[model samples]
Target: MSKVDVYDVHLVETVASTTDVKPLPLATIDIRVPLPDELIHLSLEEQDSLERHIVRKMDRRLMPIIIVMFWLNILDRNSIANAKIAGLPKDLNMNNAQYNTCLLIFYVGYVITQLPSNAILPMVRPSIYIPLVTCAWGLMSMAQGFLHDFQSIMVVRFFIGVLEGPFFPGVIFLLSCWYKKEELIKRIAFLYAGNILSSCFGGLIAAGIIGGMEGVAGYAAWRWLFIIEGLVTVAVGILAMFLFPDYPRTTRWLTKEEGLFAEWRLSNEVAGIIDEDSSGIWWGVSEALRDPLTYLFTFMQMMLTTGQSFTYFLPSIIKTLGYNNTITLLLTAPPYAVAFLGSVALAYSSSKRKEFCMHICFPLTISVIGNILAMIVHGTGARYFAIFLMAFGVYVVYNVNYAWVSSSIPRPQAKRAASLAIINLMSGGATHFYTSYLFPDNDAPRYYMGGSALTVAVFLCAMTAITIRFYLARLNKKIDAAGGDAEAALRANKGHTETMKAFRYQLHWWTWPLPKALGTEVISIYHTSSKSADAAKIGKSNFIATSTEKWAEKHSRTLETILCTFFKNGTQLEEYILMLDVGGIMVYVEIPESALPPLPPGLITGNNFAPRESNTASKKEVLQMFKLKTDQKIKSWVEEVPMENCIEAVEKL
Candidate 1:
């Protein structure tokens, strides 16, 4: 009997014998089939184009929302400094120490909440969590306008900190979820540009509010600053709820195909490690705590934050340039504006070259020089130029360092989230608390002590960056040497994946194109049971194997000719799977019976076949059987065959 006849008879008998069990649905099974080489290439090209389109769409939809939110966040948080210059201290009866204490107190709430907030981020929708906190902080910021004394303002600031704490780290975590490592730094820089622009324009805005509204409606100018900025923040927060895209996996804005592609691309980049589950949050935290690099990076960030603390006392620093309230605030604008431009330039260069270390080292070294010049330079022009250097260096370092943390710790999403929060909390808290004391009211004209301290911090940050570069280098070497144990090496780090064998660390000064150099290798294994007709026909004979170029050429013609002859009516395979084994290209075709011609004399038709009992064939057992067959194919396929004939036979199967 023919195979089709035998299969039909077996199907009828199987249906009659099984009272409850139903035949497997075609939709439930993923049918694997071979495609023409040209089609495969076209699919890959289409996927690449799709990825670029998705990334662009994400940037358009997500970037502006985060930037605006961050702008409001920075404005609300640091408006206190502007308010301080506009008479907050005098109005509130705050001594320099009390003011510093207020800054420290805000960080007290800020520091305590970061880790927990980031840990909880995956469980709650960001659309809800982020805006809710934003609105809360805005309300708190506005409440600062009603403060009666040091204690009242301090309490308001504390709540503002608590509500504001999750934002920066949360945004960083959010960006990391959407962007690949190579594409991350630029996005981070753009997000931080909002912070820089706010600093620049915050002063200008504060100047306007303070100058024009000093006593409007019986409210102080500083009060007007807080109230206006806070209300603006609240309005923006409400808008954020409607604008912000949640995690890529769950975001509703993306089409289903785009979402899958986003997930697939990210999985491929990180070897299939994605952090989606809340159950892994604590585990991620533990992993972060156990990694020594976490502590090292934390220390480095602390020093960088200390050097960058100049932002808080910027008006004071510029006031020494012999400028009044409005002029000092205006002067503060230029340095940050210049730094904004510098940051974008540096971040773009880093992303393009795929280099992280030198970008950091170069700016930090320049910042140290700027600090030294600020301490010793006598001329006003030279001093102002020094401020420019200081701003550019510190801001660039801050931007790059944040990106570094995100890229270096690429694994278990929860751990990355926790690590970012912990690093930001520790670094920012220490800087706010301790660096506040560095520039007391007594050290006005040239805060030589502050400059010197910043010099040391910048220098230490550079050293730490070098240390991290070296550490990554060592890990990359170990990964390279792992050979078949590469997966084991990745597992040791808790992020092993099929695509990770070629992974390498991005080192600071390394000039190699790491991704291209490492290359991708894939192994395809095809398997079938010994009792199968195809298995009997082939008997242990190896199938075709060839180089990618030759195979592509050979199979391209074969598939083209076969389809032209057999599929002239435009019929095509409906259920098929395309598997790409990357490095050495190999195509394994599993032909369906309908596509083949009658069997030869030696091969038994389906009449000799027996359907496995439904009770015995549990889903798990069936899956195992399929896996065993695939494994056998992988092991047995060791010889080459005529590509044209194989294609013809597969088309006739």
Candidate 2:
């Protein structure tokens, strides 16, 4: 309703009519999160600062509790290993076979429940759901303290697995809910750091409890270990419900402005609302079952898990290096510490640069070297160093792969949820049953059979990662060749129609020799359906919303003539989409160098441009909106007419 002068704005090109836009399905639109005025008027720097502040607050409040909960998660998971070294087998009258069974049993429960647990997460408040599960596992861990036989302990371990099953996959899904694809790996690194650091510190804590608390309660030190760790976990779980946030919209602590930005930032990232799915969980499962990426990612996870099976036996491995049990436990800390630093560093780089393949593949290649060295090397120091490398490679993949799964298969929160569970089901769950036997003490020290299997797994893991990187790169080029409908190209496996439009898949970009640019631009204007109240408010008469598509469809000659306008002076127009949404329709055209000057006869800003609090918005604002939404995929924008009054002016063109 106000004039936005463009004499000084560098962004708006002199386009007379609507051009092409991104394809936005009707299901993805949500109008409740309108742009805030204070935010609307700020310089880009101020907006960036506000975004950083929101992330900072979210991290401060969210990460520590997540870290602690996961810390307890892993601490409880590995408690059995620490218990084994502290006379758990001797006291419980069990052999190595029984101990391995216990290990396998827990994972059985853990894997089985994950798909269902993640499916339920969206239906419940995460604050309540995550905590409730954490507490259930805590109770199961405490029960491990009272068990009298291998049978009882195995039963307890299975329940512990069931209770703990959802934690990691669920955490991956939860983190994806809050972060952008670019922001995901770094946050996930911090999340996995809980698992990594627990190995470092959990060893120290278990060593202390097992060594000190043995005789105090007239109970085995191993029992004291379980009892104490379980108590700490229960306490942390209770605090989590109060500390953790659910989705941004439902969270209580954010200011209205903060809440709006939180929602907008993510909505802007996906070019759609990624909230709950109206469809059932099975539909998501079907979507996941059909995506080729799901199987590829699952295989990668399986290799990574099998490659890192040494984690279950690191204590025994170090003990073989001439240390006693206690010293062996202490030695486990250093490698994990190094892995933690490496992981956090890699995660930061991956997130900052928004690249994953090299970050992932290169480390795994190093692991291959480490695995080879372990197989042939005879010296103690060299063996220990190889162990460090082995530990580093797989855990790093653990975080990166989860982030990749979330990013690559993103959407239908249900599909994302199901995909992760289905993946972990094989890699984290079923693989454990076999990996548990790979390092039987009979193969200790050299354990060439175990080391050999692990080496191939690591090598295959690296090659598979490289394969995926190139496959994705090829797909990006194909989508470009097809135009810009990433939505259709990605869903091609699901019987969706193929069109000339494609989306650039942005995860990692290798220096693959891509062809030089033939210019193409797209502008998507997303308007609510006509049945919605917001449709009437999109523009006066809703011409751009309800009838623009029809007009364009009906008037082929008029559209062809309009297209002819930009094919002037030897410059060309490649292709574009005209998607109308609650905002405005976006038109794509390349302005020739000669088209730069002279105001049109009647211009008073633009209408139905990017999401804004007021139509008093600028071209710069619209481009900024796209920059935030597409992560700069739609970097350059042609302006829509500035006001509804200009609708007449646009028609005159």
Candidate 3:
């Protein structure tokens, strides 16, 4: 399934008199030609309406399913924290230190399969893939209820981590596949808020089951906690198998027109090439590995996830407020509930404002302040307020950064998938190996040791995000300089597509009215240097440059033509007021104010001798400026052309 994009030019012309040349209308320049058969006949406004309807339909069908799946993911992964307070430690004869080991083991198993699973996801149906793994996760989590010893529970937790490993990155990759970067952040927020919402409810669910279901059917309430949550997860997985949407190209629910538009719209974003089909799995892995951003994101995510170490111990931290198990679990819900609301609001802000770094850093700052205050403040009320600050802050940091990673490296779908997997593996799995120890028993009440280390990590997380923001901005500046696609832009020196990108291909076709003296007569001659240059070399080109100012200096009929250039909206010669002495007639060209374009070998390779811009630069400076010389001619100029210029340099009679 490969798509090759070829272009057709649709142009409009405005007649200009010898007195004035009006700029071409904007409709004359848009040339993403050969719109698909489904959309080609529609008016631009009608096409826009259809695109909106299709995207709205996609969001309606996909978002809820995505949210629920993540909710279950969070529910199954974090329920153990609630179980800790439900007396599972006493039954299994495990201490707080050993419980941390259980948490560490899950990550150990979780990291093992991530890279491999992500590689396979593109080839599989996500509707089938996500649910299948989820079902396995539920089975392992359910087994935790029957475990009797620390060793056995460790095995179950490890597998739970393994089964859940691919999910977060997989979902992000899935969403990125269907939507452009601008359209994706808010959706990611909903997905992330699902997990935060799960945390809020997991506590309440634990309180009810552990409080009322104690000794139910000869099982402890902690045992029932695992059983019930796992069962609900399994049920949710089955439902997803039916309702979950696949990739845009594969989703059966879309109309044929909608499906084509879905794929076409995404292709338009990445220069008419579909990302999923651009490269193979191993190639994508190589791209991800070679990129330095991957490692930076890994380090930053590791720090952020480490800051979130609090979530694993929040139940214990809450219990220190002199409350019973049920009340403590109930108390944990409000902070997370507040966090859920904040995460969604922050996501909306990030998407609407099109910002990521500050959105991430602000919440992390709040969490850092909360951690510092929790350590210094001694009273119950002061500590609880601190919890409120931290709860919302850390969750937003997590939600916002995920969208940042996806948007920053969106080309060649494989590269994005592998990079996400690697970042999550190191940040989510490897870091937890030590971060799990952040909340040991001796650090209870204040947990100063864990709190301080995590505060530093959270602070570093913010700093790293700030650094990444500047770094990505630098990358963007380069892309802008190269035109658009960084690698493809390298060919800008010679290729048609690349050249068009270099000048952004926006141009006006104004009929150049000849001067009155040339209306009824003709003149012709060739410079000695132009013996090799001819009309064949010029071909049918989009731009023409002319100057007649040199006619005044030439006595009779020495210079044949001063300058003749053909190009689209691009580079230029030196002064806008250039002229050529063609035999006895004068030829003048009006180049738009833009960066100068490269002159053909038939014309002189001279733009340096004349003053670049004059008279307000008069829409002439932004175009490529050119200079004329009789002795040396070039096929094309060596310098790269920026998109701002669209004036040509030419002379003939």
Candidate 4:
């Protein structure tokens, strides 16, 4: 359903002269015309009150559900490192090179399909699409336990990557629509932090499973971990279908008022207009293409991902330390724990300040330092500290960038979806190339190539963040300049009236007085289609603009007989009140308040006006209501003859 907006004008006048040219009090200008209603009926203050309430409600109802499910998903899928150390590769006949190939293949499919899947998501229902995707990936991951050869494992992993493409992008888009940019960063960080937490706990969980459940059901402990974790993922995915919130407009749990407020609040915060007309998927993508910021965003994300490759193979890197399979897996948890702490702190700082470039750049610099240290050091003690730094430095930036993307591109639903997909896909595609190559077994005990590549990636990431920071600042400057242009146009119109005062003429009955202090009288004009002088008179036809300039020129003379204008609160109303010039000098007399009609219940003085006359009202009230105020007070009041049309007035003048 649609609503119509009623914009009423309120007029107040102070009579200066009550002599021969008496312009009676113009108590109000209330035009009850219809416009599309795009917001809730509440005032700004009410909306703010309700917004705070709804925000809390949504956070409580939705945040925990999304966080836990995402946390579980990250833990299960990302623990491939743990499995590698647990002897699964040997038992499954997988060589180190073949394992790398399987990992790379997963990303190959994951990277290629990211954009297309995100684009089509809304077509499949978000609730259905996300859960279905999750379940499919989970099933494939579980099947890893049964694979006996490299070919089978690679196929499963590839399919897993394809199905998982939408999870991060989809959730990011969801958060973008639900929260304002500043409010969304921490949430995105919370979600990304799950990846770090997974890194920390994957080994701990794997350690227990491998030690206690190795021979359960005649299956190896690694296989048990795969099957158990995979089945859990499938179950959670199914449950998520029931628990997940769909598109904001379609969510049934919210009240009608709540939903409308939610939609309008976000729209006001982001676009300054509500887009109930928009869609959820490709809007992000389309916005991405048109928005120059997306490219800068792409650069930031690419750099962060490059530095992040270290966490991806962290378990394998640890196994080279010569610990037994269980101990290596156990040892993996501590560095990940440190990384998790680093990421959460960085995310919190970035979100709180809404300063993405600084937060991301700082951590990336640290990662670069860590990578360099790792490259130069060889001692077990020194090298171990570098290893911890690798996770800590990389995770901080990775966590911050996800939040940044979710916040940056807003609206035209398709473009947002596309932008997120493109960013994610690019990151995945890079993983297949640079990230996979960094960990060749030949590097062995040192892994010099991996460390150096990470160092370069960190440096590049920092540079990209700095560049984007400046770009956003420049765009803001352009927006300010555009606003200034609009203000200048209004001021120019006001100056025209001041300079051309002698040419202005006023019909005695309609013209009102201006206060002495307010300077020269200036009013804007609108072209109306209706020919009636008192469109505000009893049951007269209303006017709509045909061609604004042509209508303005045509109606200029008659408008002197009918129209007048003044600023209610300085120049703020200059945009709304349309006027015509008769003579520059006009007099307005304020009538007693008792003479005006009572105001309506919802009306507020100064904000909502009560027009003195209505349908079939007295002619005196009609004339009084039409009189507008200007710069000087009227010394006298007069009821001059009303001309039938502007043509007659032009001839008389």
Each model's TM-score, in the order given? 0.72, 0.73, 0.72, 0.68
Can you tell me which runs of candidate 4 are displaced by over 4 Å?
1-45, 273-287, 484-653
Report backbone clashes per prediction.
Answer: 8, 27, 49, 44
- Please report, in order, the local distance difference test score of every candidate based on alpha carbons: 0.68, 0.67, 0.68, 0.60
Candidate 2 displacement at residue 579 in angstroms: 33
| Model 3 C-alpha lDDT per residue in residues 499-615, reported as the tens digit of each score | 123122111112211221122111222221121232212121212222233432342222222222111242223222233322211122324435556555433323122222112
Instruction: Name the runs in model 3 displaced over 4 angstroms.
Output: 1-34, 488-653
Top-down TM-score ranking? 2, 1, 3, 4
Off by over 4 Å in 2: 1-49, 493-503, 509-653
The weakest ten consecutive residues by lDDT in model 4 span 499-508
TM-score of 1: 0.72
Summarize candidate 2's per-residue lDDT along 1-653 as a digit string, tens digits: 11111101011111222324332211111112234565665443455677888898888987889988998998999988888888888889998888888889988998889889888888888888899999989988988988889999988898898899888888888887777776777788888888899999988987788767878768888898899899888998998989988887778878877877887776555545456568888877787787777788888888999998888778878888897667878888998998899888888877655576778888898788888898788999999999888888877667876777777765658878888888988888988988888888777778888888898898887777778777776665444334335555655535222121212345653220000111122111222133223322222122222223463334222221121112222221211122222234332243332553333332213223332121122334433443565684543444556677687867775
Q: Could you arrange the candidates by lDDT from highest to lowest?
A: 3, 1, 2, 4
lDDT of 4 by residue, 351-376 (tens): 54446677776767767777887778
The local lDDT score (0 to 100) that residue 8 gets in candidate 4 is 11
Q: Roughly what TM-score does model 4 have, to 2 decimal places?
A: 0.68
